[model samples]
Target: MLEDDPFHAELVGSWLRAAGHTCTVTESGEAFIRQLGRESFDLLILDWVIPDIAGDEVLARVRTMLSDMPPVMFVTSRDSEVEIAMILRAGGDDYMVKPARKLELLARVEALGRRRSAGENDIIEAEPYRIDTAARTLFMHGEPVVLTNTEFELARYLFRNVGRMLSRGHLLESIWGRSANVNTRTVDTYLSRLRKKLSLGPETGWRLSAIYQHGYRLEHMGIRSREGAAAAE
Candidate 1:
């Protein structure tokens, strides 16, 4: 853990040890960088608001230093939609808002550990859909669906926040990394394309819906099978 706050660091260290993890706590980016030069760890938990150097910078440096580093869990107090999106785009594996529950912290840590152990790259699956982040290809119902980089990022963001309604600003900043250059129209254009590609059908419970001026959400309609059409008939 790289956190400047002693209390927070000790609490997290205590939790990790209780969970049977061998953890080391450090208070500054300089120390962390020096430690990285001498020791290797299974995973890293970084505080977003750390002093001396920002947590995002630490992650970026770590990536360059280590050919293969473990997953990272960002501990942040900023819950702004834009901040979270920025963190995710900066290559952070996952995030947790500050003052987090003990269980939630542990759960996020364990999840990070699992992803590290699995040695999986950018490929991910959510039900019948398969996304190869590296190949920049998506597969739905065994059919190939091509997507532009923007469309892919938009879909991936919505999919990651499934069942949650993101605001327009949140979507724009997350997908584009900043809102100064674009508007919600860009988000809508890509969303239309993603929906056309996903094509959940009546049998499948999956659907994407726009929440008025807010943002889009991925939903499971709870309907399944081609028989669903017959039942409706």
Candidate 2:
């Protein structure tokens, strides 16, 4: 964690350790970056109001340096919806207002861990489509289908637990990484994009669908590509 405040560092670090995670607390963004240069960490817990490099700037830098970057959570005092969205768009995994509850902090931390684990490294193969959780990449018929970061995130999440009905709110929180000030339509927009690119038609029986007011699901129909393509046209 990169937090200049001693009290905040101690509190969050302790919680993470209690959850069986190794926590390293740093006092400045510069120090955090320097430490990052020398080592690899599974996750970064950052303070937006830090000395030497703001949280958002630090996140961009980290992205450039780290391949397969680990998840990041912004622990800040700013609570506005706009602020939350800005941080998330800038590549933060999640955001929390200052003085968060221990339970809330732990839960967010755990969620990030789950997302990291569920990412590209955890590839799930259900025929023509294959998902790599750690790599956050999806392959259709052995060809990679390019996805934006958010799009890949949503796809991997659905692919990880195939056939499970995910609620919109749950998806919004998990895939976007924050609940404050986010438009639910954002989820629909991303899903629409995913459907257009990833859908294999009815032959493959692999489709992303909206369940009435619920969220979305990937249903396998046991159809292959050629047949599905013909059916689609």
Candidate 1's TM-score reads 0.51
Cα lDDT tens digits for candidate 1, 37-140? 55445578889787789998998998887655668888878889898898888888898898868999888888887876566557768778777777877777
Per-model TM-score, in order, reads 0.51, 0.53
- Give the poorly placed runs of model 2, Cα more than 4 Å off: 121-233
In terms of lDDT, model 2 sits at 0.79
Q: In candidate 1, which residue ranges exceed 4 Å CA deviation? A: 120-233
The digit string of per-residue lDDT tens for model 2 on 123-202 reads: 67978788886677789889999989988888777766566566677677676655357777988888898888887457
Estimate candidate 1's alpha-carbon lDDT, on a 0 to 1 scale. Answer: 0.75
For model 2, state the Cα shift of residue 90 in Å.
0.6
| Positional deviation of residue 155's Cα in model 1 after best superposition, in angstroms | 40
